[model samples]
Target: MKLKHILIGVGVLLALILVLKFTGVIGGEKTEKVTVEAAGNKKVVETVTASGKIQPETEVKLSSEVSGEVTELLVKEGDVVKKGQLLCKVRPDILQSGYERAVASYNSQKATVASTQQQLIQNQANFANASATYKRNVELYNKKVISASEFDAAKAAYLTAQANLASAKENVTGAKFGLEQSGANVKEAGANLARTTIYSPVDGVVSKLSIELGDRILGTSQMAGTEIMRISNLSSMEVNVDVNENDINRVNVGDSATIEVDAFADKKFKGIVTEIASSSTSVGTASTSVDQVTNFSVKVRILADSYSSVKGGAKDLPSPFRPGLSATVDIESESLTSLAVPIQAIFTGDKEKSPSQAATATNDQSQDKQKAKLNDKNIKQYVYLFDSKASTVKKAEVTTGIQDDQYIIVKTGLKAGQEIVSGPYSAIQNKLKDGLKVEKTTKDKLFSADGKN
Candidate 1:
């Protein structure tokens, strides 16, 4: 009789629990929990990021101007060099023969000029003697001392001597011209031979070497020759990165940056923006055509203090960084202290309609016109404005300035100390409408000054 009474009591308890659950008692509705914090003044910094290679501030490529077999290579890679130092030499067998030929030709032409000059003097003496004889003969012929034929012979002889003198003067001028031409040829031959002996044009370290002794190379006079080596000023280093066209406009000369080199691992170097390209790079390429990536070349110089502690080259050269090392740069464009909120709180939504949505349902505007209109007033930025008394959230449009990693500066449409939904990103993004109810938990940790969760 006691066991039957216990079974009846258990059935009655289950029925009462089911009744409460089905009615408005338990598990009735769900409310999303979100972290809320008041908007406050904080520092906001805007930065642009790009990846590139580290290179020297000044790197000179050495090429052979005359094609020949490298006979002597005095320097090796990583060797510190001085200005006007002999670096290498090429086999000058054919070049030396050509140079000797040019010198011989020049000497021959000079001797010819000297001989022609002596001939001119001799011709002048002959002309003077013939004139003296002709003058006497003319007087004698007028006095009938000699026949007209004799006077004619003397006159012909004098005229011939004068013509010979004039011809000798012309020969001397031609010979002088030939001498100048030969001189120029000699200089050209010397230059060709000099090119076989390479010399350093600047004081730097040989950062690269492409050839060794007895290597045949091709060179050119009209264009750059074979790149035999490179000399770089390693004390000064810079990172060359390609920035997207979208962010290039924000980067300017003298902007501060932080550089992260892959080889350094965990260490960041300070840098400054030294150059920003005005025009776009790599236009109409296959990759760009497919992906529509437009980039501009930017250069950032690494400050000396950042890498001063790093070891130098074997020769005590100030060269800790190597060319073509992968590096990333973050250029700080702007920083300011202003009223801001958590970056998660800022989001984009459908732009506000000018009239009513129903009124614009049948609007007939061209696609281009509609696109122009949309771009004129770009995507509206908004923050969820929390109404404390009603326990509801409303979207408030805001003009955003710059943003750091964690916080975004709100230019207008919100005031300091105003409560806003700062967390539960999904709820703020998709679920929270103008009149949607929310349980605002005042979690100051969400928007801490250190930006910790």
Candidate 2:
């Protein structure tokens, strides 16, 4: 009977413990723990990132000037060439025939000019003889030694000779003009023939070759001709990146940048901003319903000397750098030393009352005030300050300035060494409120004045 009574007592004690655990008698409630940080002054350096392709600083797109079949391809891709070196040759038969025709026309006009000059000289001699004959006849007619018809015939002959001389002189002038016109045509034909042979315009490597022997090319005089190849100075390189419109304002010429090429995975090249676009460029298709993103083209020139020695020693990199390689650039935009706080700490809301003020209000009144504040459109920027004495948070309105990667400059409304809630983004943004009780578990890792953690 004594052992049975001890068993009942143990069972009752176990039931009592279970009831206390379920009811709020054992543990009151769970307090939400938060991370807090003290506001201070720090240096913030902002940077912009963009992706682009590697290209030669000076690149020339070679195209044909005269349309013809390529008869000879003298140089292949990767061949080093000097200025005026023959790169390719087109069939010159057609251009040669045209040149020959022009030369023939020019020669014909020259002969005509010579013949007309000779004719003019002969006409002048005849006019002189006819004038002498006419003078002799006029004297004879006066002296009655010659008949009237003979004198009249001599005068007519003189006038006809003069007219013939004038005509011949005009013929000479016309022939000379014709000769000049034909000479111009010959020179034009010769130029066209010269176009059949392509020569390198600059001393550089043949970076690209698009045509093979027997391929036809279009003439640039008529339209944009077929691009046969490209010549680029690989000694100097650049990256062409498109920056979004919003970020372009901070980018300027002469800014320092770090470039990472996809091919050179372990290496980073130093660069400087060389150019920025003034006009915006649209990237997507034109649509009325959807908004298109606008970007500005920026050019960054690679500083080869800066990357020659990596990590205090010359790196023996394999393979040569080539055009069209993908790259990313991080351009340092701005750096500032100012009073700042963690970016997450700043929120947008009206002034929040303290825990004591909130506790004094009725439940319905507090709910109505919260609803009104939520509906209010005139919300201001604020940060939550941890009041250690009350173990609660109060909202402080703040004026802000520029921001960096992890922090923002707080212009006003908060002082240095003041502790504020910094993390658990959800609580700072929505869950945590003014006068809400919170347990401060630990302090956040503070960044140095240089913004380094």
Q: Which candidate is the best by lDDT?
A: 1
Clashing pairs in 2: none
Candidates in order have lDDT scores of 0.84, 0.81
Model 1: pairs clashing at backbone N, Cα or C within 3 Å: none
Leading candidate by TM-score: 1
User: Candidate 1 residues 357-425, lDDT tens each?
Assistant: 423443233222332332233667788888889888888988877776668888899999999898755
lDDT of 2 by residue, 110-167 (tens): 9999999999999999999998998889899999998888888999999999899899
- How many residue pairs clash per model? 0, 0
Cα deviation at 141, candidate 2, in Å, is 5.8
What is the C-alpha local distance difference test score of candidate 1? 0.84
